[model samples]
Target: MFGVLGPNGAGKSTVLRILMGLWHAQAGSVTFQGARLPPPYDALRAQAGVVFQRATLDDLLTARENLLASGRLYGVRGPRLNERVTELLKVAGLVDRADERVVTWSGGMKRRLELMRALLHRPKLLLMDEPTSGLDEAAFRTFWVQVSRLRMQEGLSVLVSTHRPDEAQKCDRLTVLDEGKQLVTNTTAVLSRYVGGDVVTLEVESPDVTAAVLRASLKVDARVVDNTVRIEHPEGHALIPRVFEALDRGTVKGVTLRPPSLADVFFHLTGRALSSRVSNEPEPMTIRTEGQP
Candidate 1:
């Protein structure tokens, strides 16, 4: 599975639409199974399924109804269609609510149903855009569990787009995009190796003072944001005693330190914090026109 990791307006969704043939790209061609995609793109689309960021199921329709409709659209029917729906229900853990209306389903359940709908055709490639956006911790765990199982059972080639660093870490590989351009694509391990250190966050009343002392004493990189002084050190823990000694003489408040995370990797590459940079505004999933560039 491939992943697109970027901020809200970084054009991840735009790329997905182009791949799906719902929109076209001006500068590049999309190939499927090693062939340049043709017009109409029906052949290419048949091999793919998409789950949008927002719920697409009919509110009045039951879970089973939604799946059956999707299967019908894919020309699946009779015992085979029923069997497939049943299997997907079990996979998504929605069997108990198979007859429940979508309007009554919880956010997680609706998301699962959408996933099941996308899988109804058993497409070779599955594209998901922010599939776990509004889910709680428990729901997120359940979603990933099902995803891992599906990947193994169906050998599905999955591509997911998300802004969450933790979610990006779970993917097999990641494509980090910024401002409509691909920055880097690699495994989590490879990216982490570049970090080569732990992250030290100091919650001090006077961040400027703490940053000054750390800069003078340690051969490290540091920055201040949100009243917190963040430092990157190869041996971050080893520097704690020295840091404490220095902060003790200043107007310090608190300190926190930890190993490098995906967030740190993002900051190191982008020169900005991921959480702080992404907009809180709800972004709509829309198609990008092709050949406009």
Candidate 2:
């Protein structure tokens, strides 16, 4: 799996739409299966399954009806289509609910049905845009479990765009985008190492003041983000006690020490939190392309 990681207005949806040929790109070429694609991207669209950021299922349609509609678009029909739909519904654990309208289902169930619909034609590639946008922990885990199972069973090459760190971490490689610009592209492990150390965060009464105090007194590069005083250092284990000693009584409400994560890498590269929103419109085809296994 490969990931395009960024927050809102970072062009995740726009990029996916362009790649799927649902939206036109001002420039750039796309090569699929060793052949360069022409305008309209009919070939790419035909071979890849897509799940947009927004739900596209006709809520009034039955779960089975939705999958049947998608299968028809992909030219799967007769016994083959029936067998495929039945198999996918079973995989999604919605065989009993297949005849029910999608509007009556939970968000997670609808998302699962969407996935089943995407895979009904057995496409070579899967493109998902924020597949777990509003799902709870249980729902998110269940959804990804189905994805992992299907990928392994089908040997599919997947491309996903999401701001969720947990989702991005599942990818074999990632491209971090900020304001539509590719800030970095690498494997998640290599990208996480760019932070160079552990992250020590202090939930304090006054984040700015605490950050400034740590910078001046401890001589550490402390930054305030999301109302927390965060200090990134090579030896966080040794720095923790010193940090506590430096702070005044009752100033800190909580402290957390952990290894560097994707969020830390984003902060190191962009000087801002991954959750921070950017308003810039994406330049067409600004993506730095890479191979997907």
Candidate 3:
């Protein structure tokens, strides 16, 4: 599995749409299996499956009807189509609910139905954009479990786009991006090493001043991101007391020490956190500890 990982508005969806022939790129050529694909990309479309960021099901139709209509669009019909639909419904664990109107189903169930529809034609490549956007932790785990089973069964090559770091970690390889620009591409293990050792994040009233103070006093590179002063050091446990002694009393609001994560890697490369929440929105200046979740 390959992942396109980044924060919001990072062009993940645009890249997927371009590959799916839904949008046209102005300058660059698109290729699949080393062959250049021109407009209307028939070859790529015929061999690829897509699950868009948003839901796109006909609520008025029954789940079975929806799958049947989608199958016919790909020129799949007759007994083969029926057999395929039955197989997919069983795989999705929606066999009992297949005859019900889609509008009555829960969001996760609808997402499962969409996944089955995407695989109706048994395309070789599966492209998913934020497939688990609103799923709870349990539902998210369940969804990916189905994907893994399907991958092994169909020998599929999946390309998924996600802003969530935990979701990206599930990929075999990742391409991290910032504002549509590729920062780096590598395995998760290699990328985590970019910020060696422990990550010390300090929630402070003034991020810029605290960062400058740490750099000037300790001679360590520090970055200010989203009201937090972050430092990468080999000895985080020993650095906390020095940080308090260097800064004025009550200057620091909170302190968190954790091992390196993909979020830390993004911050190391760009001096910015992975979150792209609106600037006007008030976010609590609390970073996740080692095992808060």
Candidate that scores best on lDDT: 2
Estimate candidate 3's alpha-carbon lDDT, on a 0 to 1 scale.
0.88
| TM-score between model 3 and native | 0.88
Output the worst ten-in-a-row residue range by lDDT, candidate 1. Answer: 277-286
- Where in model 1 is the C-alpha error above 4 Å? 248-250, 277-293
Write the residue-wise lDDT of candidate 2 on 178-274 in tens digits. Answer: 8988888999999999996899989998999999989989999999998889989999999988988898988988889999888788889989898
Clashing pairs in 1: 24-290
Q: Report the C-alpha lDDT of model 3 over 226-277, residue by residue, as the tens digit.
A: 6689899998999999999999999998899999988788878877888754
Q: In model 3, which regions exceed 4 Å deviation?
A: 276-293
- Candidate 1 lDDT over 107-206, as tens digits, reads 8888888888988989999999988887877777788888888888888999999998878888888888888988888987787766768888887877
Superior by lDDT: candidate 2 or candidate 3:
2
Considering every candidate listed, which one attains the maximal TM-score? Answer: 2
Sorted on lDDT, best first, the list reads 2, 3, 1
> Ranking by TM-score, best first?
2, 1, 3
Which prediction has more favorable lDDT, 1 or 3? 3
Model 3: weakest 10-residue lDDT segment is: 276-285
